[model samples]
Target: MATPIQMPSLSPTMKEGKIVKWLKKVGDKVSSGEAVAEVETDKSNLEIEAFDDGYLLQIVVGEDQMAAVGAPIAFLGAKGEKVDAGKSAAKPAEAPSAAKPPPPPAPAAKPAAAPPPAAPAAGGGGGGRIAVAMPSLSPTMKEGKIVKWLKKVGDKVSSGDAIAELETDKSNLEIEAYDDGTLAEIVVGENQTAEVGAPIAYLTAKGGKAAAAAPAPAPAAPAPAAPAPSAPAQASGGGQVVPLRREEPAAAGGRRLRASPLAKKIARERGLDINQVRGSGPSGRIVKRDIEEALTKGVSAPAAKKAPAPGARPAAGVRPEPQVVPLTSMRKVIAQRMTEVKPGVPHFYLTIEVDMDAAVKVREEAKAMDLKVSVNDLIVKAVAMAVRRYPKINVSLQGDHVVQYSTVDVGIAVALEEGLITPILKDADQKGLQAISTEVRELAERARKRALKPDEYTGGSITVSNLGMYGIDQFVAVINPPQASILAVGAVADKAVVINGQLAVRKMMTATLSCDHRVIDGAIGAEFLRELRGLLEHPTRLLF
Candidate 1:
């Protein structure tokens, strides 16, 4: 039987996914559980694995393209199977139809005074011109960057013309013009970032003056009546010099830069000091060309120089040019979550040093017996066991209430190439040392490969973060939200200790606990650590 490969729902909030790359082409033999493509979800990149064995017959979604959830991305059948690829493509349109019910009310949610309907007056005093503001494209988007402007000044734009591309935090999307008119002015140029409601351009009536937001205002109050030149002045090129003047920008209001909207937008996008860009337009007004010239010649504001100290030596060569890269979806979410939890939750820290000599000996003996175990594995087991004893620390702080857990689920922080992911270890307190080690290793491997499912990464009562492999002696970790506490494990090193008035060397390790003060008090956190330390020092208790 031929099986249709549909796009899987990778996350709870994922509406669509981009096909990053296809690993198996048509006519290739594929087996169940084999990765057929690499998909980019909203959070991270993951492999799309096959569920049935067959020959790869077709790929409906190409690379670097998006498809809604349940869309048929590919097809699999026998080697000589004849598949209708067009039918596969047509079936996915139903998914978008099912999703159309939620978006019709979005426009109604905006304020009644939104500029889209009343744009003509906002654009200019005349009814012929229309204002064009940045559109809110996504539910979470607060601002967007103009990737590029497809339409230029004086260009005619009609409804549904893709006038510009916007880069949101999630993905780059194309935006269309709503009204048909001449592009009279471009307020926001290529690469400029603007708020959702901020105006970016203007549209004027056909054959109307393209001057609603044009640069170089006409001179006000007319030419002076008393001014008269008896003789023309000689030009530097042997021609007569002509005096050209323009209205002082202050006449309209306070002093303002005499620049076109596009020029200002370009300056902002390129991080150039507009004041330093020499204007070349009428009355020495700045324009788009001036900005381009400044960028081409690398003209920037002068840096302030400081006197060196008496014995300070001059540094060597010029510094490399700085580069700006946009943040990934995972990084953005991590930043937002961290910012929300840091000041919002009142947190306190507690650090304790543990003697790991006994656990070290046990690990050595286990290695000799062909049983592999890591210090982190032991720490995870210890933390889980301790949580089972002190359920207070294994609880979350909900609004006006505290929720306790019946089972101990520990989260192990695993760092990836771009960001970090925490995979949960369920029922850790009941699992033996060997089982815990196996599960942690498997979870970590899948996490780095981005192959774990949503359930595998969510729902942990507490978190364990170990920096011991990096040779970090001691450090504190931030609390993962919803959970009240997190344990930071440091490297195990030999330290000098005094035993019965005699100096002795011992294996010492340090662990820091960061707890939410709203839920677990200082005494409760300390008690939890004490129990964890006891379990770690006495490894025989873990065996029983």
Candidate 2:
């Protein structure tokens, strides 16, 4: 019996996956639990393994192809049995020229052997087109510039291999090829920008001979003649082309020059376009190396008028110029989620000051023992212990029910190059400070590199965001959706306080807990924070 191998749902949020590669080909024997293919989800690339021992029958989804979750990607059959090759593979012939006309086979022209049917063009080979969309490089990036392509038309690309580099507002990011296939076409060019989700290229599963043949004769035509000089001059000046004057010189000789005092001043400062420089100073007398100095400085020549400040209303005669950028997929999601949380959930914040002298001393003691635990790790441990005592704060809003989690999965907010991401430290209460610190560091490093798996970013019962390293005295963070509260930790500071009627300086830290009103009321949230403060103030409670 043949069993259809459907694309497995690797993550709860995964809608589709791109086939990275097939480890086994048709007719190869696959054992249960053996990796058969690699697939890339939105978050990470995962290996797809075979579930049962069988012969590889067919690959329905070619490498680099994307299939919706649960779609058939391959098939398996009994070992040694013939497998269906589907609609591809050539059919067997009935007979080979029954009445063969022999003799005098030599031809005058040989017909050029039909040019051996030129190999299918890179991306057009497959009958169907696979759209390569512009990738969102950052959470706030709405569009990206196609800086350059790493793969050209007809080049074969494998999964995980960089296909192009995209420039977002934040930084340049390498985009990977989703499937293994010939790059069919490049719809976007270098320096050209496109919105996220827009098609930047196309990939065909099979090479297209017809499309490949279409460009063979394109280079035969001569290049178009250059446009008239005046046309370019007007366009460069941001104006419509004007007819050339009858008295104008047929050709402007080398360095046809002129300059003004203001032009020279601007030139010295900016390295301006001297030839295009217009002098506002007294009668343009080709002032002392004006244009030359400007050109050397590379500064913008004087404009006809000054530009207004950004977003400022223009005068009656002028309309304000505005630049528009589309919202990127990541940015769009962030905006939507933020709006939903802001208005839909009633939020209340509780702030408390904790004495961190003991906590710092404990950390110093741990460091002496070769355990370099961070203040964050200490806070995480304290929060986990507090949650164990006050479980109500470690719950999420799930429709009519408040889902309380038994185990503590603490989400430590990390700032990545792309944006903010929170990776979980599971069972934080069960782990020691050193273990939590190591895991948090590893997760943060991975988050910055966009290498975190979906599981790392999901299933956290609580979240913690700290800006103490940055010297933030105090701040409050919105609760992550579904989760009841988020803890914001501020920097530890020395403050003068009255202890038993004596003024003394003590190390103190401020923390603010933002709770979702539906899941955690002010009293419950405050009690949790009080417990956390007590643990930090005592420092030994975390160990117990």
Candidate 3:
């Protein structure tokens, strides 16, 4: 009897793979240990061979298509035998997205081998446990540290409750339950690390036989789940059934402001202090209607002075006894990314100097109005405005696709004791100088306290790394992966230069832009720098 050969799990973490190409054709003779097709896995592309001697009968899954682990890809059988695929008991496979045209009728052969059986139920909730796995908190994250467990074994939890807080590469994130269940077991303990997609805990369905665990059909993969609970869910921070982030009053310096994104954007645009408009939405969350009402009530926006940079503690001598300190998640990610970027990615550098006298004058005027405007704030706004002209530099290379982002989201790299995190200033191109200044200050403060959410620090079109506060004249920065360019801003110091063909002292800052050669060409990088330099030099134009 002809049998379907299921797709094999080449890598432990690979849930599915794209069929790159088939090495054999339909009706071709396939023998055991013969390579039949190539599959592109999560890490790399490898050839999948046949496990049994048979003639190729039919290709169940086509080329350029994806098949889930343990799904059928092709059929294999003895010569002169015809298989009835339609009557086969296997569930038909569907394309994840827009299905590509089926590959030309060619030699259909057996898969390299069958996938291994699923692992035993986690949390010891055999056949009924809803195991929660570690999700990828950030795009480049491989694993996460279990900071602490909010729920323990035998504790009943409702849908949308935070089960645990996982320390990711970028920030500390809370993973919530999608369905009501009792925590059956804790597979990973506090202060330990687990790879993404690895089970950290298990849950038993509500009213189940025991508080042990439930199977997939029972409590996993809820209809409304973005990362269905059955698998290591993507921990969207907040999902529909239960919100990870409650719209409670979050600290903005001392004042707590809770508002919807639309309301905040409207408030920022109207130059109104959102804090003045009391929220009337759920849990006092300010909505768009509230902002409109406030506008009608003649509420004006107030410019907040940027938070003062915290002063460093007094220098103390090292302790007499030496001890090794464990590396943080941030530090570990930085080390891995730094190691891969140097040798794997090609980089080209471009340096440009800007006269900050105009920017300096603007800052002084802002200070007179009690607004805290810094030199870096000006650069951030300028870069945001500059990227609008050349959108290619603001795109990311995702697999084979070049994803052009819709907004000029700029990342402001904030230095911390453990490491550094780049908090995204979303839609910076549309924001005013005051908004950028205040937002950056607030983000830096949260970053230092390790209170930032994943969305705040990930997915930026470009990054601005300024070392001017450290008294560094100029230095190039390594490119953050996937981003085409990173701007390195240096200190504004008195330098002798020929301006208008005359030697004069001017406050000049040198900026170096490190660009990835694969995504950005030299011409595009130069144009962006030229535009940035112009915007910073003519500081007044940035307002328009």
Candidate 4:
């Protein structure tokens, strides 16, 4: 019987993947539990392992070819079995010899040697138990840096026990054991990185006999000290060096090519080629060291002679300055989305100044009680509560019919080193002040690290943007489409005002509400803001 190798969905949101490489070729003997190929999904590159052993009969997709999940990529069958080469099941394999006419090979021979017996499952030495891959901590996190391991191999573990501390792009997360069992082996070490969905360790059922058959324990090793300079190089099984051939030189006028700052730094220190460097970094990025190492090793041609002084240049036109920039993925997305929304949606802006003296007093009082809550948290709670009071502003615009939300999910804009992401406070109206504060802190930390899930960024009824920390007075925000409005908060400062016919100073904060005219009218939006302003000013209303 032939086994179909279909593309597996690496992540819940992954729709397609690009075949990055084939570890085994057709006619090669395969075994269950052996890796056969590598696939690159939207999130990360993962190895696809064989589920059944057999001879590689056909490869349906070649390297770099994209296929949707469940699409067949290869097939396995018995040796000497005739495969339907003409069937749609087989995709053209990527072969260097296929590009040009090649000499015919000798007559078909017997299939190659079979793989070794399958290794013992991580936890199963005496009883059968499966290993659970580390859960993805965030969307942008491809790999996690292991900070420490809480359990040693052969230690007993129970569900929900913290097994490891994972340093993600956002924060340090504790990886929990998902099953009750004995730890079999740790595939990855402390400080080492394991891609999302890649097995990090194994677990065996408690008191299972299979646990005694576990392989000899390998010595624990330290994780990578720091982030790799270049995109992570794929490692072959057994850690053997796989020679990578460069198809083209990456130099100009004998000078090594230029790439990213990080790449450049790495290149300068290592002396590598910029062109031959295949960036596995974010978005196929090439960096500095990729070029530097090539240069140091004499991989690229020697540097050319320096050009004449600027004044010695021939009386030609003025020299143009080169523009240097490092655009992040988030910035690029923001640019494209803003451009799309500006042209397609009719936008309207409204600004309102909210008196926050009471809110400030309440927060101060809460602080005295050791409840360190922020004004933003209170605003989030207030907005969620107000949405229920004013359902018109909580609605999303849909074609023909208006889509109104019964529950309020408030999105708080959090800024990261690379970009900005919004992590929603699910059912904010139902959560109390302390709960909202804790969740906001957690989500903000995750958002900054790019670890938020897709659901965390979508399906929000309204958004809140605060520049109070930066001391901005007030500013109107562009409406994030589908939802009706977004609130922009400015700095809270003391200003002179008349109180009961006497001159006094009062703490004031300005808030601007940007609304989508298609769904929320001026009067309706204004009323909502008015109510929000009253809550913030009185502060006691929030306590009630």
**In terms of TM-score, which candidate is strongest?**
3
* Clash count, candidate 1: 0
TM-score (all chains, Cα) for each model: 0.41, 0.48, 0.59, 0.45
The best candidate by lDDT is: 3
Q: Residues 121-239, candidate 4, lDDT per residue (tens digit)?
A: 22234454445465555556678888899999989886446688777665565676534678888999988997765568888756543332222111000001011111022111111
Model 2 lDDT per residue over 1-544, tens place: 6665656555445556555445676567898777777665554455677777888765555544555555445567776543333211201100111122431123211211211121122223425455566754333446889988998998876533567877665445566654445688999999999875566887654345323322211210100011111222222221111111111121223322333334445555664534444321111223334355545544442322223323343322122221223444663454456547777766789999998899999989989999889788899999998997897777765434445675677999998755788888977877888889999999988777665543466657789999999999999898877577899999999999888999989998999998876556688987898899999999887887
* Tens digits of lDDT, candidate 3, 187-260: 99999998865678877767532222233122211111111121222222111111112221122233324455
What is candidate 1's CA lDDT for residue 272?
78
Output the lDDT of residue 81, model 4: 61
lDDT score, residue 394, model 3?
A: 81
Q: Summarize candidate 1's per-residue lDDT along 395-465 as a digit string, tens digits.
A: 76544445566557899999877667788998788788999989999999977765554445655789999
Report clashes for each candidate as comma-separated counts: 0, 18, 17, 39
TM-score of 1: 0.41
- Tell me how candidate 4 scores on lDDT: 0.59
Candidate 2 residue 224 Cα shift, in angstroms, is 43
- Looking at model 4, which ten-residue stretch has the lowest summed lDDT? 218-227
Ranking by TM-score: 3, 2, 4, 1
Cα lDDT, all candidates: 0.63, 0.60, 0.64, 0.59
Report the error of model 4 at residue 396, Å: 8.0
Which ranges in model 4 have alpha carbons more than 4 Å from their true place? 1-13, 16-68, 72-132, 153-161, 177-185, 202-350, 357-378, 390-406, 411-426, 431-465, 475-486, 496-507, 513-531, 534-544
For model 1, where is the 10-residue window of minimal lDDT? 217-226
Ranking by lDDT: 3, 1, 2, 4
In candidate 4 the C-alpha lDDT for residue 440 amounts to: 95
